[model samples]
Target chain A: MRRVSLLAMVVVAAPVFAGAVADLPSGRFAPLYGLDVGQTSFPVRAFRLDVRPVSRADFAAFLSEVPRWRQGAVPPALADARYLATFAASKNPAAPVTEVSYFAARAYCSWRHGRLPTTLEWEYAAAADETRRDASQDGDFVQRILDWYGQPAREGDLDGPGSPRNVYGVEALHGLVWEWTEDFNALFVTGDNRQDGDISKRFLCGAGATGSARREDYAAFMRYAMRSSLEARSVLPRLGFRCAYDDVGRSP
Target chain B: MRQLAFALCLVSLSAAAQGEPRSVLALETRWRTESGEQVSLSARKGRWYALSFVYTSCAGTCPLTTQKLKRLDATLAKAGKPLDVVVVSLDPEHDTPEAVKAYRARHQLTSAKRWSILVGEQEQLRTLTMLLDFKYSKNPESGVIMHDNAVFLVSPSGEVKATMSSLDGPLDEFVAAVPAPTKGS
Candidate 1:
């Protein structure tokens, strides 16, 4: 019985220690907000990212493992009401989970021995267009992404994993749902950018305080704006998340 | 035997007393102090403290925040409250133990036991910040982090009582939130 229990422990512990992830090599990609006037293509460290957004089923497992994270069990400081309501109501565990706050999403990722991808990592992965690594300039790809943004988020589960893989073999970069990055709060826009006088000034300061690196990229601009508008505890109807990891031999 | 049983019952009763929830105090999480000590926030219980997020090298709102905290420290000292202050570095990659010490000395926070300047690995720092509901973002290009400027007032029991955006504003709420000095002192 002792040996059997020990074997069971390792079987359960293996996945917790070695999370499900896909490795991406070290690369460079220009982010929407970080570029200076002339600079482009900032370097990204090699990392592992989840191939798909966390599904309703995946989140249900997390709730079982960490009971404090369930919609009613969570503190108001970490997640507001309406969290995971759609997934709970639909009872369809296969759909991608939505209405998760940054705190809850982050907690879920942490429980899986992973963390949310930084915006740079998320954007860099999204820049791929099924065949090429940098597809920001691809008119058709950009248009398809922009068009998806126009559609209103509907109820019920969308597609499950492994459907829309990118060039990097990572799935569901766009046309599925908006994801929460680890640095969701870091995308700072000056008060002038928000066009709301004096509010942004109260909290933000410093250089590059002006407009985006490329003002023409309205799609990227909208992403940044959405990120900036969120507080840590605010859960949305459509926003969900996945996880990332530092490369195995690299010190985090 | 009777006294020991009564003490055990008292301990369990106190544990059940959830009147003040220290929701943010994940005492198990480890952190590095400015003076290079490794301690948990739970270790600092039994005194009221104020907590804020800052980066030592920040050129923006962080310096403004530090200045405001310095003034609040002095104000509290004069008022006989002499509250504890904790400033955790949002940019932990750059704010090393030695650097955090230098920043503390530079700010002239003399009370070592009261003024705690802390830095931790990114994950631990994130855990604390999430509990405090403080949000921050670092730009890899400019190396500047855009973050929340909220300061929190915590009770002696480790519960966060109130949060203020800027110390430059009216401090009535902050003063009220401050716990009165204990009976002896």
Candidate 2:
């Protein structure tokens, strides 16, 4: 019985060490942006993604290990004036961390031997509902996402229930917070996005509903527009991140 | 430079640990030069320089940027405030040493000793570009890289002093931003 108990302990311990990742299958992804004039779907390779957004507790542990990332110690180039502002608000171990800049989030992932997901990978994993993969076509799933987007910002639901686990076993992709991607700033917006919107050739796609590959995927376009507007160092109260791993069998 | 001023969008950056302006020198990523040697930018510290991104095979815009840079170099030299030009390759997968040599010959840049062309891994390229707000993305299918045409004037400490568009923006303001050469070198 003691030997059996020891074997069970090892079984539970292995996944915890791996930080709970899910292996998403390879697919042809059609992101809302980045496709050129005739470019169709992007061939997305299979990759591992964190099961949930990086939690406040996870980041706190990282900060403890690497003090340079502590609230006041981070360099100005790596984070903004409000970087990690929510670290102290809630110590809930499972809540998504917020207010981390792209650079800082990238660093945390690097320290863990992983990196932030590409925009395509993130969107691909997020397209699923609880029961089915590729549910972006489902009107109910689309409306539910829009409804979450329309809701008022939660003050600080450190321990609130996350988005239910999807078919891929990933959780809290939505109804949680916006995330940092590996190349969030690669977007080319029409007009001077940094300035007043005007006529400019740099406008990547067209504009409004017309700019998107799938007009029905308005929620994805909103996410793209929001991503385009951000600077690498701009950290917001709702912006957090998760890490994606390259090696599937190896623990992160 | 109306377009340039709009594109740069240089935001307020607080001083670094050295109490200096936010500097790109803090990045530790090393790059491979035209000689195929990997090196850090630290060797070029303590001297103001101009940096831009390009690909040897880029048929559009990059050539324009290079010509503008050559013109800018001559203008600075004539003004006695000459600065080195650091050009990073956008496509390392194809910008091999031979391609770099061909590029130098095609652009007539072989005699342009002040210019340094460097290339490295895509990850490093992305990191450096992000820090400088030098946007670029390579199309996987066509191997075409769509990038911004901005050129940055960096300080001795690696902080960006000013920027200008190489495609159409004027150059007088960018030239004036470079500090005059210190007395007696």
Candidate 3:
């Protein structure tokens, strides 16, 4: 068996009796990247995602098991210089661990017998509000998320700064830290901004043909842009990740 | 003196043959070629090759990328440089063996002797892509798959050697970098 010793620094996490997993029901919703021509809706099945981003303590526990992933021990191909930079400075175990590369994040999730959520799963879950499952159309909801996007990243000890909880009992989906989705690199934009005519046709596949369904939704567009800019090995100061499990065959 | 010289030659030849990283050679995932022939990465041993991931239905970078690889292969062949091209499907769900064959025919890439367009199970694809650090995802709503557009060079020992974002990128440099196959490797 492969062991990865993740060092969990001393920030404490609140105990969720349910092991910190929130079960989301199946539903259909319009994603930021809209449906193909003649398609009406996107169906998302039931699954469990971490209620919060993986925190310092959680990652520390991971490091204690998987030593290969520790700072300096990890290969440059797997993570860049900034991987786990946050854990090095402060011992805020409860704060969300940031500065992790997609490879490192994926390894963490796989170790737990889970995987990173798909782009659609993340988008579908993030679309919810405190009460409503789909609050994307509400102007106030959209504005608040946009405001969070514009604000500068908060520095140090980000354990639990109390972002709004969605109806599914998930926390800090936004307004805390940017996240690593399994398919982050799938959002393709050309390296150069030489857009002539029919940008979608020139660059992307089916969904790219139609562009974004909600072109007015700047917040969604911003998310897409951010996702597009990342590479698998890129480690940023504000980026972190959580894990998700398949609903089938796994007892949640 | 003759025996000692032969022994020394054998040691050097074995070292040259084992030059690739052990991790890459250990990969045993199976993939079905556009011609419906099942193969594995290890089957590509004994030959230098370049690989890229794309789907047949893609109206985006896939076509141009195919053309570029075709050109690279042609140029190498004309120069009498031996190289193989392997294109794996990112949209394996839609790019069945038949679909891959159609794609090959459409692009005139039917030379199984030179080019191989392949598809495999999702888990197999995942294993290969992860090894190469290739990222891809299917748009759930649209059924469109998007992926990183990059080519990887694999040495004759089946180890990944170099990567390029586009097919037209630094071909000469890559050609110079590729390790020649050891005899009987």
Candidate 4:
């Protein structure tokens, strides 16, 4: 067997987002954004939001419209109809679709005239706070996130479009299913390879101790450890993705 | 701010403990191989092992991974050397010994002395996988197993030496890396 070095130059395009809506406060418990190694804040204009997660009904429509999406037509590994959670059986057509791979999700996003959100764009949206945090200090931005997560999701669930504004006016950041990012290797915290090293540099939303934070925090370490264990291919039922479109003027 | 700091401390301690390899954490407490035998990393010490985590009902890369392992086994046999192939089931509740036996036969894994399929409690599987940095999650609605697809090669001392694409293409590199047993064994 040939030993091919796992080293390949990962050419990642910058995340597409609109202009800096506001410089929000960092989450109290979360790591400060842009503190990570090799962190590059992409031009915000490239990302157009898909406010909600893709639903079962949405994918069913896709399957019907796209011949390649039919069972047995796509990659054999992904050809199972069971991949799409049936809305009729669950009676929750609005629930995020489950059992789909990053590959399948990417295909769906491409078919829908959009692309998956990059890790930077996803974290910025989740951590952004328009009112209390965005208007105040970066610490306040972090505090708002802590406050949001502190309360029961059902109680604090923001409704309507403008109820709770993020830096970019996006809402429902934390409560939604873990969104898929376009850069699969974007958040590597620790490991043997340079690819892993590069990911750690983009640590924006994950809980971890930066050079500024006290290094002895146990909770921060656990969060970072869990983050490090993640691989691009691992998918969970609770994991769903939102689409992003390159704003007409900003796409490269 | 004080409370947040304290919480962060607790998280870091737990994460640090998890990151450090807990040598005393026994694998036997967590899982058993397909032969209904308890498995422990310590038990397999002093031999190079190929490890893959899979479930029985997988219609995707799991079967392909198994076939790849079998091909690696054949290559090893041809070289007059033998290697240990350990397939740890990610779906322990459904992948019972009987189910594994059937899977083994279906895959024509008749040469059992060199290969072993193992399943154990979910907690044990989780612990072992975490130690190896293998990520897996169960889909609650469909009960499907979602996991990373990399095979680990463990050194004779039971530490992971390298991770490879699959068992087939990287067979020779892995075989070369394993330390040959001492004479008069």
Candidate 5:
């Protein structure tokens, strides 16, 4: 594969009985985007999330069993040109899979009896560190993630350091790959300061920072901007996803 | 040499046509028509149509979109295609049969048999929007919805033939994309 061996180095992940889903508690947090004009934080329900992104080996097996989702078999409307191109290039059994489109990711999660996490659910989990649950404001932590994001992608570069197990024991929330959220295309904000709606025009005038709860959270902004730039059929080399289960009420 | 060249040209043409018809019609959902009749995209497979999304209570741009569709319907009818325009309600939860009927009455579309209004759950709408690459979002508190001001033309085989912004742009190109009416009505 042009991406070399991602399944081996990208995120083997830690062994913390993380195989079982992590039951995240419900809470309200203002996202980088998607808040109403007068609203601050939207309510997030308690949901069970996979501790790590779905890996290449898991996807390879899925492709074998579900031939419809395999390369060339998927409809052009459901996946872009480069969908699953890496799977054809090389085989990395354990590293996380990349180049799966949002539709493909949803199909995969559905095959496992789960669904892609909502943007709020994903952001709520991703905003954590080793000690505190929401380390988004921590300068060093955010800087570390930003540094990783700044790096030019190189083959074999993805092999270690899976964003340090967060408070919820979920790893690779960042510093690995961008993920597909269930409502990734729900919001249609332009990359510039402009957002849709009459209220947004009035409220988000001049700088777009006022629209978000924390204007300082640039990392979340970048993520949201990246998501806004994508279509449901887009597939990228640095994109992967995990699943969330609504059936599991709370972690035991 | 002539036969070889002809065979190669035929190969290319066949290759271009060999793929699943990746269009909105492929997605399956039980959408209730304005008359409360359950129908899916497959029900509209025999003819070409214009597709767009709108809600009855939209205070902002839906009325303009509806007006544009009316013009587009007239232009196509004049062009002899008389393609039907199918509009799905983005706010399926609020747009019940009664609301759809009221919308038809308000728009003076009660007699326009060619215009079909389909109301389905948000789940199917989401799926169809993704396939069409159409964007839409509703603010829970404000009840304000932001959506793409777009319209699409679909072929009888269920593939999108052309697209244009409903809020702007002339219908000349979009009209040209619609297939001519087949023989025998």
Candidate 6:
């Protein structure tokens, strides 16, 4: 076993506990809000995210039974076919697939009778407060993340900060695999500037430009820059996604 | 003298045959270093370079990876085989040249020529990352960027020699895995 010491200077502040909410109804969307100065919101819908990322063992089970997973039949540009997580080899059967692609993730979602969350829906759920408004502002995202990072991450069990907590009554939102959304290309802006366009083309108006306005005014820009770094096809080691369902009550 | 010459020839031939340099498509993108000078991948190909993806605001594995790279750099220097260490920012939005400079200073990476930090346009970085098979994504709501953690070793001839995962490997193993610079190259 290789012993590696991390020089990360993180100060895990005492765990701040919030009041527990009622259990969210199945197939309903919930909001996971951030802690910042102004309004920042991500609306997360309620669906079971595989507790862990797709593991090697989970994938291997699929490989043995599913013909599509075999070598030469698997999708293009997938990482090494042999490496699996050590923890996954001994874990439960229903754990989340960790190192899978957007396509693979979609396949799994399809298999489970669920769909990937739309980008808007995903963001709305992720940024929503306890009441689904911007309790935390855009400017404070980095600090909140830093605060989260400072805390000791709970492992193994699925119900923690990233998992559906008993307190907030929502499922995995942060610190999990960067979840995939359905409408990954939708752009958002407030006031007169609100319009939808090609997210890639709007890079200039998006994040990376600096000003007080950039900080306070251009919330959409920040979101766009953040999402633009991702390739729709690639699956990162840290990237994992959850599934969402349409509101049947509203649709009918 | 004839035997010694024959042995030397055999060694050279084996070294040439054992090293298979894979051609990597290097993109030309301008990045400002801590010193405020513009730099690009094309300019650094003649020397062995170890490149890692990082953002200054990252509180998770980036710091660990940087510390490991710094250790590798120190080890290489002690072994008299120093190489260039380059950190390319995955989050160009927050990781400006000034911010990168502050990050370097925080980690005490002041040695000028051996280490260089860079930040550039997101598109160019995306292109470079694609070519290198590096994957990353950012949460639109929180601005948290998640990326694959791997250090890529590029040869002096602009070829990708090897890649090492940051989570579960010895730095010494990765250091030893790096192919030594060819003599008189």
lDDT of each: 0.68, 0.74, 0.68, 0.53, 0.75, 0.51
Q: How far is candidate 2 from the true structure (C-alpha RMSD, Å)?
A: 7.5
TM-score leader: 2
**Total clashes in model 6, counting residue pairs 3 or more apart in sequence or in different chains:** 27
lDDT of 4 at B37: 66
Full ranking by TM-score: 2, 5, 1, 3, 4, 6
State the DockQ of every prediction: 0.13, 0.21, 0.10, 0.02, 0.16, 0.02
In model 6, which runs have C-alpha deviations exceeding 4 angstroms? A1-252, B1-26, B182-185
Model 6 lDDT per residue over A104-145, tens place: 555555654555666555554454344533333545643443
User: What TM-score does the predicted chain A of each candidate obtain versus native chain A?
Assistant: 0.80, 0.84, 0.82, 0.57, 0.83, 0.52
**Candidate 3 global TM-score:** 0.74
Better of 2 and 3 by DockQ: 2
Q: Kindly list the per-residue Cα lDDT of model 6 for residues B88-181, writing each as its tens digit.
A: 8888888876788788789987655678788877656755665564555565557866566788888866677777765456777667866665
Native contacts matched by each model: 0.19, 0.12, 0.14, 0.00, 0.23, 0.01
Q: Candidate 4, fnat value?
A: 0.00
**Superior by lDDT: candidate 2 or candidate 3:** 2
Write the residue-wise lDDT of candidate 5 on B6-117 in tens digits.
3323333432222333588645666998777888988888788999999999977788889999999999888888988999999998998999999999999999999999
Error of 2 at A5 (Å): 34
Lowest lDDT block of 10, candidate 3 chain B? B14-23
Clashes by residue pair, model 5: A1-A89, A1-A90, A7-A95, A9-A159
- How much is the lDDT of residue A147 in candidate 5? 73
Of 3 and 6, which scores higher on lDDT? 3
Error of 3 at A98 (Å): 1.2
lDDT of 2 by residue, B66-176 (tens): 998989998899988888999999999999999998999998998888889999888888788877766776766788777777788888877888878766767899999
lDDT of 2 at A42: 86
Of the true interface contacts, the fraction found in model 2 is: 0.12
Candidate 3 ranges with C-alpha deviation above 4 Å = A1-19, A188-210, A248-251, B1-47, B56-68, B94-111, B114-116, B123-137, B141-151, B154-185
Q: What is the lDDT, from 0 to 100, of the residue B83 in candidate 6?
A: 82
RMSD of each: 12.0, 7.5, 12.5, 18.5, 9.5, 20.4
Better of 1 and 2 by DockQ: 2
